[model samples]
Target: YFVGIIILPTVREMEGREGESEGGTSTATTIRRLEIEITEKRRVIKREQAQLQLLEQELEKARLQASKEAVIASQCVDEWGKPTQWDDTAHEVLKGVFKKKTFRLHQLEAIRAHLSGEDVFLVMPTGGGKSLCFQLPAVMPGHALTVVISPLLALMQDQVYQLDLVNVLAATLSSADDEYEKRRVFDHLRSMSNKGKQAPSPFLLYLTPEMVVKSKELLAALEAVYKAGNLSCIAIDEAHCVSTWGHEFRPDYRTVGQRVRSLFSSTPVICLTATATFDVIRDVASSMGLGQHRQGGGKKMATFRSAFDRPNLFFDVRYKPQSNKDQLNALLQTVQDCTEKFGSSCSGIIYCLSVKDVEGVAVHLREHDVQAVEYHAKMEVGARKRNFELWMKGHVRVVVATIAFGMGINKEDVRFVIHTTPARSISNYYQEAR
Candidate 1:
């Protein structure tokens, strides 16, 4: 009886303990579910926060774009409240001698718009008459001045020379020119701006970015001219330098947009580049604050492409052993053959990979009884000027240069361009070739 009594109490106690354990397990399961729900809620909040930040950024971008569009729209209107058209005389002059190409329509339209005080970006090919877009406007009445910012002094000089041929009063400011000469040029410009002048001054002024950035006097003079309402437009030649990816990176080019804005807010800016990829175009437009103007209805800028194909020329690539003397002789022989067949009037360019090569090749050509000249960055200004003048006047038949010969050069009759080595990139090749 005693054993039965002890066993029965123990069994009852074990049953009660099992019931308490089950209750505790159920409470722990409820706590785990609550913790899981809290974690999910935190994740959802974080996702929403990220989305909000993205939306904010997008909204800011949209606002900036809208403001730019509004400004452009306001400025594009004519005095009579209509989309402007080119002047009949201007149109006739442009279309008469100028051959009609793919961009002719766009060019005419751009000229008209620019004359009416609207900024434009003409992204045309190298030989696509980009200069005419601004050149024609520069000649128009009431358009007081067109300041062209070129990357190189040689280019500025070449442009000025070409403009002079057409009886356009054009002046260029470069480091090559002396201080006295610069002062004289500045004085002449001031005289032209005088309301009582008999013969008006040059409509176009070409300057390098370095001249503008480094000289406080030039900047002041430009500001004064702008205040007098003589500055009508600012043209950036070879504008791709604004992009870091461009073969030439000019820090001065980056300051051009701000300079335009500060000095001549009413004056329109025209950016011209020969070769630019889509990404490069976007980068340039962004760096120059042209992103909004380039975009249309929230879309990317439209690129104007002419035939990049040069059908008249043949393309060939050759890999030869490293024999400098043999290569030079062979190149000269080929040039002679081409000249003999194509006649003495056929002009060509010979590119060297380095200044040393340029000098060496030029000397060899001279020794071999060829009228050749060397052009590189290291040459003194007087030497470069003399060399360029000799080449322009047909005194020299060939120029051996270090890839700096042909930029903004107006020599249209160049029949051939020989490369000692392959160009650094296709853009460079096309630039030199064109």
Candidate 2:
């Protein structure tokens, strides 16, 4: 019947061509052609439906594989503290969490070494993303908590604020945080410690060396984390402080390394500093028990060094005037030039050696119609914080402050940094100059 249906059409068409009218076409022949057309259409529809099903299955498989990879990435390390699929995981967090597209020089090396459970000593200049080295590893899922011991409370507060902006879970323990805030942070840690099967919550904790040594609440929280075997790494910011030879030597910093070692012997230590001489480096390494200095010299640490030279920054030095009025004029002239060049969005710092000088300089600048504010250790905490934020947000053109102003400050558009008096030491000069 099928063959006849096909052949009969040709036969009829041939006969019609001999002299049949167009109307002579039969209904049965037309019906047979329509049936064939419907059959072909049905065949195409069936094939398309099968292809769609196959595609859906493949998509589901891909999704499952991605989910599995995410879990593995979160659990970045194996039982022995060896990295598993770290490259993929680190890059994912770098982009997804930190919103950075690429790692700066020596950044990946420092982070990778620390992730593999090796101590790291990194020397990168200010604004070189030094914090990200430890911070990147700290934010990874399934990674243990990272404790950062820093000497400056201002730096700690600034870092915590910035981290919060990016939605990264970070908390700082300092005199700045109120009792309620401190208790909240401590309670969170305690809760994580109490969870038996659940993993300890991952967070970047910033603390001063004194807090590590003196704060019983902080020590208790740390002990809880330590008992859970969830202490990931300890990063010492401004690690040069560990050396007496360094410019900003604090006796409290000396105890931090020893105390951390005694508590969490196996946790990796990352010491980061912007300025460190050979003597300072050796002292820091030895004091931290890193590299060959470790007991039995088990695993040597990796040192990541990037050149401190920032070619984009230009330096100019001029002799100060002996007269106070002349000094103010010179400073004002320099600041005006800088502000004029950068226009309204200009941000700058004028460092003074004392709180009196900071207030005086700020008053002078304001009298001259310069948008300026004063910040120093002696100022009320709220006032200093408010002024700093005003300067950071470009509401103020310049911040006249003491040495307390610039540490860990992330303002990138700052056009000039004018020191009204000489810094106490070369490292202090270098730190504020940035």
Give per-residue CA lDDT, model 2, range 156-235, as digits (tens). 77788788878988888777777898888888787767646788657888998988888877887888887887788889
Residue pairs with colliding backbones in model 2 are none
Q: Per-residue alpha-carbon lDDT of model 1 for 272-325, expressed as tens digits?
A: 777765556667766655524322423222233333565677766655546877
- Candidate 2 global TM-score: 0.77
lDDT of each: 0.72, 0.81
Q: Give residue 180's error in model 2 in angstroms.
A: 1.4
Candidate 2 weakest ten by summed lDDT: 72-81
Model 1 worst lDDT window (10 residues): 294-303
How far off is residue 276 in model 2, in Å?
1.3
Assess the local accuracy of residue 1 in candidate 1 as a C-alpha lDDT between 0 and 100. Answer: 44
- lDDT of candidate model 1 versus the reference: 0.72
What local lDDT score does residue 157 receive in model 2, on the 0 to 100 scale?
71
